[model samples]
Target: MSDAPTTYTGAVKPGGPADVRELGGLTLTKVAVDAQMSNNCYLLRCRSTGEQLLVDAAAEPETLLPLVGENLATVVTTHQHWDHHRALADVVEATGAATLAGEADATAITEATGVPIARTLSHGDTVAVGDCTLEVIALRGHTPGSVALLYRDPEGTPHLWTGDSLFPGGPGRTTTPEDFDSIMSDLQEKVFDKLPDETWFYPGHGNDSTLGAERGSIPEWLARRW
Candidate 1:
């Protein structure tokens, strides 16, 4: 509904889709797209199987296509926000990969992007990304159905892809007090309390942060009440 653009100058280096970074055993590639809003799209590949999972097709299908490669197994839309799905239609059309999203937002995502979501995900659901599985952690509030994807490596340290729910210093923006309360409660119980301090969260936009780094700011985030 809002077309306000956002940017993260230092959080991530905006690069072409071909750039790939190592994340423990997996390969993580990120590209920052500047459109109505600046959104960070990520592609995660299983090093062993070489299968891929595309996260948030924010914009520019041409750029995303190369990063996605030929073994894309699933395309995940973090939420139903327009900004996040801008490139979804084209990317899905090209890849023919299965699309997955939270059940509550599936209809809206389909209506907005004109791309059918192949599977509906809920809290505790696991999606296979090659040899690794991404566990869905539903975080309600930003939308009635926003969720975070978690992939735990062999060492137990988790990598989280959070879309507009939990951020670096605080929770995502909410329009009303009830929505704020809902997000705050879920984040406290489902995320901050449940996930380990070593868990690194990659947000939809901007920089990534760890639970350990943000643990001390919970009280401040709560006190601000925004």
Candidate 2:
């Protein structure tokens, strides 16, 4: 949406990155497809219960259907970025899954994907699927409505599906005067500082990382410091 180059673009391959890992009894799969060449999506499944949550479906519905099976509980968009919501309509129609995005993203989601969102989410809201719970954390640097999902494992390690908010080595860009300060401060205090050191980061567009790994990069964000 910011004219930034899209990342994932290619034929819909059957398998994703071979090294897909299982954490906290959930199978995490990354689907890298679409014109942006971005990490178009992620499928989080509870291995024991079989319930699933689809995060940021970036391609057409048909392209994502094979990757998502009958157990999908809901589709949650991290933000209203075009690459992230391009396939919203198809997914909703195909799975009949309720779509949820940040409260501020509902309008854009409806406009871009032509589908009325079933619910709006905000910080602290919890969406439950099977035995897993995804707690919403508003992370608005990249976009006004961007949010992250936090899942705490039994061992106390937190797994974050940080849309485009906090990436491997840097936080998402703050493109305007109003969003630059408030969002960055919120991220540092509310997200970065609060997350445990061992938290795993499953971002929207890259290889997975850990909170400790990203913590080392905070200094780089000094230039954008509020």
Candidate 3:
């Protein structure tokens, strides 16, 4: 606790120089990758035993694999987007890690990545990384099976990994008004309402933002319908 990082900036780029944050029992590393997508990837390692789990093996495996050292226990694809899973097959092959994803998107992810999901997560389900636990939340838009992972530390503020579902300024892009409404409703209820304002969220494509920072803009987000 004394040596833990107080906050995570979540700014990163492809290749070297990942942003690392040491929470109470979990160590989080964020890397922004390219294929020109500016996609984000997260590595969550357990402090006690070094059991590692990765979220979105987006791209640039050479840069990401070393960050995990060896023995990555699991990889979770937040959704079935091609950009978000560009390196999924390579990562799973390299580490022999079991994969997880939202139930609705599991088949699509397997279709895209050629790697099967060992487990399909649903809303309220939990993912364990060593001693820490991440709660799965179904966001239901931007992609049919989009999911966000929420982790609450016993001694710190909660953190969320929102893969293309919600971002700093607004909800993730949707193709239609109906899709926009679906994502927005989930954000308002499953995310903004259930979680506290102090919760820090990591988006799939950009810098980190807190629920408190974006809460006031919900009305504007609704008006714009993006």
Query: In candidate 2, how many Å is residue 215 off?
Result: 1.4
Q: What does each candidate score in C-alpha RMSD?
A: 6.2, 6.6, 1.5
Measured on C-alpha atoms, candidate 3 has an lDDT of 0.88
Off by over 4 Å in 3: 1-8
Q: Which has the greatest TM-score?
A: 3
User: Comparing candidate 1 with candidate 2, which one achieves the higher TM-score?
Assistant: 1
Q: Comparing candidate 2 with candidate 3, which one achieves the higher lDDT?
A: 3
Q: Give TM per candidate.
A: 0.90, 0.86, 0.96
Distance from true location, Cα of 133 in model 1, Å: 0.9
Name the TM-score of candidate 2: 0.86
Count of backbone collisions in candidate 3: 0
For model 1, state the Cα shift of residue 213 in Å. Answer: 1.2
Task: Name the lDDT of candidate 1.
Answer: 0.82
Q: Arrange candidates, best lDDT first.
A: 3, 1, 2
Q: Which stretches of candidate 2 lie over 4 Å from their true place?
A: 1-19, 224-226
| Candidate 3 clashing pairs, residues 3+ apart or interchain | none
